[model samples]
Target: MNAEPADQIRLLEVQALDSRIAQLDHKRSTLPEHAELERLGADHAQLRDLLVAAQTEESDTAREQTKAEQDVDQVRQRAVRDQQRLDSGALGAKDLENVQRELASLARRQSDLEDVVLDVMERREAAQQRAAELAERVAAVQSETAAAEARKAEALEAIDAEGFRVAKEREVLAAAVPDELIKLYDKLRGQGGGVGAARLYQKRCEGCRLELNITELNEVRAAPANQVVRCENCRRILVRTADSGL
Candidate 1:
């Protein structure tokens, strides 16, 4: 906290820069752009869930449909051979009985195949519904992504200009400070939220807003004019002016 009047001025500039940066950061985080980002995130999650459900339904339907088609084809082929055998009239009694048994087996296979096909159709219908919902969600998220990007661009363009201007002034002020003092100020300022410098206002440490005791004030007063004095209360470097000398 032992810093010159010049260095304290620099510290004030740094503090100002820090304040501006803090405001810009807050504005950036709380921008309308961030709201859409949140909405986009939610939409992204919901779409992912819907996509999973659709994929599951589609996969199940495909499996069931394939099995049903294969079953139906096998059964129809057997049914055709059975009918040919019955039409040929070259079958003995045992052959006719075997043909009838084969026909009965084919009929039962066809019934099972029909049931599987019905279930697959239902699954496909549900999958289509979910797919449509997912598509809409994806589209909405995509739009939100676009809008948020635009909003970010606008916010950055608007706020960064002023921040850069103040930052340049801060740099100018910092150049006036000695390197070792700048380092010390940076170290302490970080701990005090950019308040490394305090004015001796009404015999008080403005940084901590606490009045200095008589002994400390006397000690500070005895210091040389160019010498740096630190506040005992908040450990902030103090700058005394003639109008409000401590």
Candidate 2:
């Protein structure tokens, strides 16, 4: 493919722009904010699960406390009724003794139930504290995730803007070259590790960073200025300059 020397030089500019675009894409993918956001998201999920568990525990414990208090109140009420009957002087000695014994039993029951209520209340308090702590953790993680998302968005926007600019420059550069030459360059670029053209400087193929043998250098020297030459080693379009040492 014979392209004007000027058009061939434009291929190098297009290659530069393409390379920058590729770099920007890579930067967009590997941004640190992405990794941070992923980590924060996982942490947020785990904290939410823990918060749910703590809330369930607190609720269950609170119910247990309520039931214990109700039990105590029921036993106290029975004791109160028995004492009132004994005080009414309507009972015989045997009946009064039975009433007093029943009241004593009720008092013990009430005491035991009160103890249970206290224990359950303590447990409920602890569970409530745990729930609060978990909720705080979830909130913190949510904040971090939001910040990370914002940072990721900002970075992506910048990268995309720059990539768009570089692509536009590539388009303009590509348009200046003949269609046939552009096709050839595109095909080579697709297969040449993203480099379709490279400069031949000091008898070296810049694409492969390999110096040409004497015979290869001589053939390139004999080629006309407008004749397109390819690197024997890497098969990339080799653009010659004054310093090519050919």
Candidate 3:
């Protein structure tokens, strides 16, 4: 980051470029698609569970319907048998009345059970429809997840390549800088929030993007070339430049 005595400011340009590249990488890694894929996965899992639950309910309802149908058949058979017995005069009048009453009760009970079966069937049908809709939705989300993952992977790969290139550049530049000055900058950078130097653009401190104070700017201008000047606003090492990007 520096030379014998006055080259500390020379590294400010590379530092600014590095900061910009790092900012771009941060933005790339935080794309919406990354989080979106996770949400899609969670939704798909829930839909699959919902589908399984719907199928289970359908099975249970079918069993209940079969049992209800068999119960109705049994009641009908018993009523027919009792009617035949009454016709054969195997029972007295009072007994016939009791059997008829019992038959009427079974008919009402069978009617109630059939109604319940119908309700359960309707519920199962609705659940089946819901499950089908969920299945389609899950498939659609899976497609979206694939596309998002591709985009995210491409972005990460590009950033990784760019980072490698920049890291190589940093290594080259760091070697050219004096060991003592580089060590000094590294120490200051650790204490200065990982930014050891920043450029002066117009009358502002580029490190904090703030306007420099009149006193501070005058002091920096009067400072010797070999001397270090720090920004009062951001506490970052300030490097005066002939040209600074806005």
Q: Each candidate's TM vs. the true structure?
A: 0.72, 0.93, 0.77
Q: What is the total number of backbone clashes in candidate 1?
A: 0
Backbone N/Cα/C clashes per model: 0, 0, 0
Mind giving the per-residue lDDT tens digits that candidate 1 earns over 76-108?
A: 988998999999999999999999998998898
Tens digits of per-residue lDDT, candidate 2, 1-246, equal 687899888888888887888789789899999889889988988889889999999999988888888888889888889989999999999999999999888988888898898899899999999999999889888888888898989989999888888888888888888999889988999999889999998999999999999999999989999999999999999999888987
- Alpha-carbon RMSD to native, per candidate: 4.2, 1.7, 3.7
Return model 3's CA RMSD, one decimal.
3.7
Ordering by TM-score: 2, 3, 1
C-alpha lDDT of residue 3 in model 3: 39
Ranking, lDDT, top scorer first = 2, 1, 3
The segments of candidate 3 whose C-alpha lies over 4 angstroms from its true place after superposition are 1-9, 45-53, 83-101, 210-219, 243-246
lDDT of 1: 0.79
Q: Which 10 residues in a row give candidate 1 its minimum summed lDDT?
A: 1-10
List of clashing residue pairs for candidate 1: none
Worst 10 residues of 3 by lDDT: 1-10
lDDT of 3 by residue, 88-192 (tens): 888888998998898788788778877877887787788778778877887898898889899998888888888888878887877776676667667767777
Report how far off residue 240 is in candidate 3 (Å): 2.5
